[model samples]
Structure formats: structure tokens, C-alpha cells
Target: MPPCNSTSHAVGGNTWELAVVWGVLYSDSAVVWGVLYSDSAVVWGVLYSDSAVVWGVLYSDSAVVWGVLYSDSAVVWGVLYSDSAI
Candidate 1:
């Protein structure tokens, strides 16, 4: 996982044949919400705060059931998904 500041939160997953799901939160940013799914696991939602970033798997199956917020230069507030096996 990458390094995050005190105001930032990050979630990461390392798996060989599974999927991961999670949430993230960031301060001083907009609000975001979404739903994601994986072949190995199911994620209903994720919430985050305080300059947090949402990161997902590179090759995981996913579906967006709602809205999502993302920004490279600004803080983000919402759910996050990552790698998982179950």
C-alpha cells in the first residue's frame, strides 16, 4: 500500500485468486458513494473521510450501483474497493 498523510486514508489488497472490497474517507472534499462486486467477493458499499483515496483492483469485476467521487488534486469522500479472495 502507498503512504497516506494524517488527513488521508488508503485501503489496499493483495491476493492471488480472490477479490477485495473496502471504503475510504477524506476530509475537505466532496461526498461519494457506490457499489462494487467481484467474482470472489461482494461489496455493498464503502465510506471514507479525511483526504482519503479509494483504490481498486486492476483486473477485478465490478459494477457501479450509485454515484462515485474522484479527484487527483482534491480530497475525496466515499467508498473504496480493493483486492480480495473471499
Candidate 2:
């Protein structure tokens, strides 16, 4: 694996991978959440969350399934979103 920008960990009992960014992006204060991988080639992806996850740019080599659930909540996705796979 390449050097991460910050801390890293595994999810779903070593199923899905995750990384915790401890640095800021650009001059704007932000918590970078990166899904780092050696290769962007993937055919499957699944995300499960009880709250809400607002994603901006999603870089992937395969299809992605963003699953979310919440009560009395609002959600919206724009065309600028990148949800594609190889």
C-alpha cells in the first residue's frame, strides 16, 4: 500500500477499506476522507450508514452503491457526482 495522508483502517470486518485523513485540503479547513486503493479497478461497492453522508467527488474504477437510511431527513444528488465503475 502507498503512504496514506493520515490514519487508515478496515471496515465490515476487513471487507471494505477506509482511511482517516488528518490533514487539511487546500486553504479551506476540511477533514479529508479518502478511500485509498492501489488500483481503481473494482466491480462492486456497498455503503451502509444510519445517519447521512454527503459526498462531493467520488473517485472509483468500478460501480458504486451508496446506501443510506434516515427518518424525517432530506437528501439530494447532483449531476456533478461521479458514481461509475470499470
Best by lDDT: 1
Candidate 2 per-residue C-alpha lDDT over 1-86 given as tens digits, one digit per residue, 9 for 90 to 100: 33454333555667544443222222123432433233324322222233345444334445553333322246665543345542
Model 1: residues with Cα > 4 Å off, grouped in runs: 1-17, 30-39, 47-86
**Model 2 backbone overlap count:** 4
Taking all chains together, the TM-score of candidate 2 against the true structure is 0.22
List the candidate 2 regions with Cα displacement exceeding 4 Å.
1-28, 43-53, 56-59, 62-74, 78-86
Local distance difference test values of all predictions, in order: 0.40, 0.38
Candidate 2: lDDT of 3? 47
| Per-candidate TM-score against the hidden true structure | 0.20, 0.22
Model 1 residue 80 CA deviation (Å) reads: 22
